[model samples]
Target: MNTDFQHGAMGPRPPDEDAIMVLLVDDQLMIGEALRRILASQPSIGFHYCSDPNTALKVAAEVRPTVILQDLVMPGVNGLDLVRQYRQSPATRDIPVIVLSTKEEAAVKSEAFAVGANDYLVKLPDRLELIARVRYHSRAYLNQLQRDEAYAALRESQRHLMAANLELQRLTKVDGLTGLSNRRYFDEYLAAEWARAAREGSPIAVMMIDVDEFKRYNDHYGHLAGDEVLKTVAEAIQAHCRQSSDLAARFGGEEFVMVLADATPGRTEELGTGLCRSIERLRVPHLASRVAGHVTISVGGALAVPEADTSPIRLVDAADKALYQSKAAGRNRATMMPEGVA
Candidate 1:
């Protein structure tokens, strides 16, 4: 067997870069030389040879030949077994295999096809027939490879698009200034939570919060300072809510709202009072206010067990009425709606 292969002598073309490349695996040097001469005339076809049957698969992997010409008889090796091994390998499984034999026999041809040989031909086949079969199988293999690459690219593009859409949806629900849920999202959440509470016979709490004399604060301190104050208050309110079932939102200018699931009236009042004290502790200056020297907040809350027949608006209206009472009563206190009011 010739150890020296003819691929380097024929001038190697990069694997998968060329349209067609042929690997001839035969123990006989004469057979390899004959096939090389036949394919040498075609400038488009690249030719490679491996005389050692043992090294045929390794050579095929390195060459990445589009089509392989395999012989049935080689010393210490069965060509059919080699074809089966080629089919089993991930690297060479998709490459077209054409079995070359000495005589045309029906049993040999049938056995060749049974073991995954694509096409079979007598040794030293007519040049035109050999070239035609190689081109036919190689064209189909290349087309399949291109399609696989295109499909993979499309899936990756879809993955990125879905991630971007999720981020966009999240942005729409958030307030740009306070990083709290916006009023629109708050309303949606309240309605959904109300329905859930009604189903479970659980109590829900709603709180209305207002910065005391905010217009005066904005006028005395520039609008930028007032904005910072609102952000600070929003953070305090969000932090005080604590539970995963609690949600805080910027309802509008100088006002915020919170929803708490499964909260009792006493618990709601306690949280509201704590929030007011937390803001006061910040010691933010409010020179123009009638409340206190430092900034203060007024809170009013309502707790109710939602019923299927009742509207969520009733709860919000009750909370709002309580908020008005807080403003009227010294402007810096927490007030809770009386039982049966909501």
Candidate 2:
């Protein structure tokens, strides 16, 4: 059979800047040398040869060849059988294969083509034809490699962008100094939790906290000292509500809010007391305070099973009232709203 392989069958696109790797599986060592000389002028083409047909697959895996040249007849192995095996392998399935044979009988060439041979050629092809086929198949192989690399890179970039977007969303709702959710996040979270509680028929609790005599502390210790106290108090609140669903937020200067979902009136009171004790335990000196010798906090708590007609604002208002009641009765104490305030 005359070797007249068409170039269009190679690939639609040309090769990229990367080098192309080619593996030759010819039992005859002389044929391997001839191939090397033919491809020596092409700098971008890389070549590997295997004289033992049994080791061809191993060499193909090592080189990860873009194109393979197989000799049809060998001592113990038929090149056609090797082509079938290569086509079956996940690593070599996509690689193009061309078979080299001494006989030009049409039946033999047909069998090679049937067994996954991309093209059939007579041994020692014309130098010009050899160069053309090698370059054509090599270019096709590198094109696929480049496309795969680009797709992988795009996926990685998309993953990084998604992570950055999530962080940006977190920052928008987080207080810079106290590391607690800001007022904006608190309001939104309260409303969403209230709605969810209404749907689930569960009770939600709110705690309104105030720093006892904060102005006097700031006046005596300086504003910077007051800022540190707020941060410490915020941390204490966070430590108290370690549950994933619990939210402790800075409502504003000197005021903070804690929202708890599926919580009971008793849990509310207990957490409120714990928060007060935590602040008092800080021992942040508040000598100017009338409430306690050290820094202290007043807590107001309210629990309600939300209804369709009720809004989260009602719960917040109730908690605020109780906070004032705590200050009025005495600071450094936790007080729940009067029973049946709604």
lDDT of 1 by residue, 1-342 (tens): 456555433433333434588889998988888998988887777788888889888888878788899999999999999999999998789889999999999999999999999999998999999989988888887767666765367557767988999989988999989989999999999999999999999999899999999999999998999999999999999997789999999999999999999998788989989989999999999999988999999999998999997788888898998899999998788899975588
What is candidate 1's CA lDDT for residue 50?
86
Worst 10 contiguous positions by lDDT, candidate 1: 8-17
Which pairs of residues clash in candidate 1, taking residues 3 or more apart in a chain or in different chains? Answer: none
Cα miss at 120, model 1 (Å)? 21
Question: Which residues of candidate 2, in runs, are more than 4 Å off?
Answer: 1-147
TM-scores of all predicted structures: 0.57, 0.57
In candidate 2, position 177 carries an lDDT of 88
Q: For each candidate, what is the lDDT? A: 0.88, 0.83
C-alpha RMSD values across all candidates: 15.7, 15.0
